[model samples]
Each structure stands twice: as C-alpha cells, then as structure tokens.
Target: MAGYKFFMFDPDNGFETYKTAEEAKAAADEAIDYYRGDAGDGWPDEVAQVCWGEIKQETQQVGLRPRDEEDKSSCEMICDYQLTDI
Candidate 1:
C-alpha cells in the first residue's frame, strides 16, 4: 500500500510521524513511559517535566495549525516519539 504520513508532537522535541495513527500513539505512550521510568531507571523529575512540557506545547501548536494535504507521501500528523533522548 502507498505510504501515508501522520503528524505527531513530542513535548521535549518537535514534530514526528508514523505510518498509522495507532503506531504513532503507541510510540508516544512508550516514550512517556520510558521517560517516566516505567521500565526502571527513569529520567529525573526535572528533566522529565521539562521534556513533557515541551511535548505538550508542540502538540498544541501542531493541533492548532491547518492540516497539510499536499504531503500525500507522508502522514498528515506528526509522530512525537524519539529513539534517543533530546
């Protein structure tokens, strides 16, 4: 199937994407859990708080903007998860 892009926002980071909404949301939750130390040895409260704040701001910003229909090859929304810490 042809790939479609979805936009997702990360608090600490900026914009991102996933092939599907489910994939993007799963990634976001995983990131939150990981940062919060659900897996153990989580990030410091200060760091986590800052990161989360950034993500929340970004999400809101993107949500307020108009959707881009020109980018058919990419998801319309952004993915807010990262494999590495920012």
Candidate 2:
C-alpha cells in the first residue's frame, strides 16, 4: 500500500514513510524529544551537547508529502513496524 512520507532534516536521515500521518508525526515527535535531551542520560558533556545541538536544530524542521509525490531533496521508503515486531 502507498504511505505518507515525511522528510526529516537530520543530515544522516532522509524521507521516511508510514502507514498513516499520525504514525509519522509521532515518530518525528519522539526524535525531537530525544534531540532535546529527553534521552535517559541527557547530554553527557559540552562536546556531545554541541554536536547533537546541530541535529536538534534540523530535526525541528520537517516536510511532508504524499508517497507518490516527487521531492528532489529526498527519496521515500516505507518503514512500517508490524504489531508482532513490537
């Protein structure tokens, strides 16, 4: 089935597809939280904080498009998680 795709601006990341927009948004929110120091350990040191700070900036900026839509900056692929896999 076709999916909804969202572009995550993290340099190491790319377009990700989900079965629904809610799922995509939830995933993005989780990543945003992690980047904001929601990780259990938080930022360990200044260098680590500084490095991930850049990612935190970009992670807040996201773009969404339908699966069939064309986006020159990224490509899409489904990454759905199955219930059984949970």
Candidate 3:
C-alpha cells in the first residue's frame, strides 16, 4: 500500500486525480461538507451529515465513483493510472 495509488476527485474535470491518499482524503472531507449542506465554510446540517453517514457505509475510498459505476473501463482507468505511476 505504500506504493503510489491513483484516485479521481472533482474540483476540476479531466485531470482530477491524486497521487496520495491524504490528497484524496481532503477531497472526501470537502465532499462530506458539501453534502452536509454546509456553505463548505460553515457547520454541517443534519440532513447533510446523514448523507455523509450513508455514503460512509457504502465505501471508505475517498475519490472513487459510486458503487453502481462498475463499468470495466472505469476499473481499467484506475488500474491504468496505477500503472502509469506519474
């Protein structure tokens, strides 16, 4: 697990990838805040927190797509990035 891994997150499109888990994690925290209906600079609301809770039950991987996106290309892309090791 110490070797580099690839992750995709959005604040931008196209090249939205992370080289480290910590980077992906920051994006996940931001996503939780966004879902929590925070101004993203303010406290989280109950509904948003509940949304976070639900997604948490789904997966711990920060920048991964939803569980339903099981396309082979998506899996390939993650692997492709890992292989590239940029």
The lDDT values for all models are 0.48, 0.41, 0.41
Candidate with better TM-score, 1 vs 2: 1
Error of 2 at 63 (Å): 30
Question: Residue 56 CA error for candidate 1 (Å)?
Answer: 19
Give lDDT: candidate 1, residue 53. 16
Between the candidate structures 1 and 2, which one is better when assessed by lDDT? 1
Off by over 4 Å in 3: 1-4, 9-15, 38-86
On lDDT, the leading prediction is 1
lDDT order, best first, reads 1, 3, 2
After superposition, candidate 1 runs with Cα above 4 Å error: 38-86
Residue 6's lDDT in candidate 2: 33
| Candidate 1 vs candidate 3, TM-score winner | 1
lDDT of 1 by residue, 1-86 (tens): 12534444556556565567676676666667656763366565533432211222121122333347764546556434333322
At residue 81, what lDDT does model 2 achieve? 32
